[model samples]
Target: MSEIAVVAISIAKPGCEEQLRVALEGIVAPSRAERGALQYDLHRDLREPRRFVFYERWESEDALAAHGQSAHIGAYRKQIADWIEHSEIRVLKKIM
Candidate 1:
């Protein structure tokens, strides 16, 4: 079985960094409480203030898929749609 992970990158719009941060922050607590979640962490790029990355791990690919379809994530995507310049998501597998 593969160990699943997600590396999501987001760039906030020129003046909407705070709003983007808040929206991301709002989901952490609930996401971490998810049954199949192993880890869910957020990081900001010191070199680029408007850039944020989410490092997440899950028990399996199915868990991650369920999370993508979850209500909170759906709402979050919609909420940040206008505030973000762009977003990139990569699903990964542990190699080591």
Candidate 2:
């Protein structure tokens, strides 16, 4: 089966870039340890300090789904909900 990919875009609340960075860093270890995870990277926009993105690759759809329910992700969601101004999470399947 083809792997699944996810791109998550987030905007931090005003003056909360550092907090967002701390929160994102906390999830890195757990995400990397997930059984189906191939890659999980976080990037901050050079042009916009408040903008952040997460690029994730998983072995399968089921694996991505499992990641959604992961305790680390759940904690991140709760922790960042109030600290974020906006968020967009996209799941993709590689075609080429």
Put down candidate 1 lDDT per residue, 10-34, tens digits, no spaces: 9999999999999999999889988
Where does candidate 1 clash, by residue pair? none
Model 2 stretches astray by more than 4 angstroms: none
> What local distance difference test score does each model get?
0.93, 0.93
Compare the candidates by TM-score and give the number of the best one.
1
lDDT of 2 by residue, 9-87 (tens): 9999999999999999899889989989999999999999999999999999888888889999999999888899999
> In candidate 2, how many Å is residue 53 off?
0.6
Q: For each candidate, how many residue pairs have backbone atoms clashing (under 3 Å)?
A: 0, 0
| CA-RMSD of model 2 | 0.8
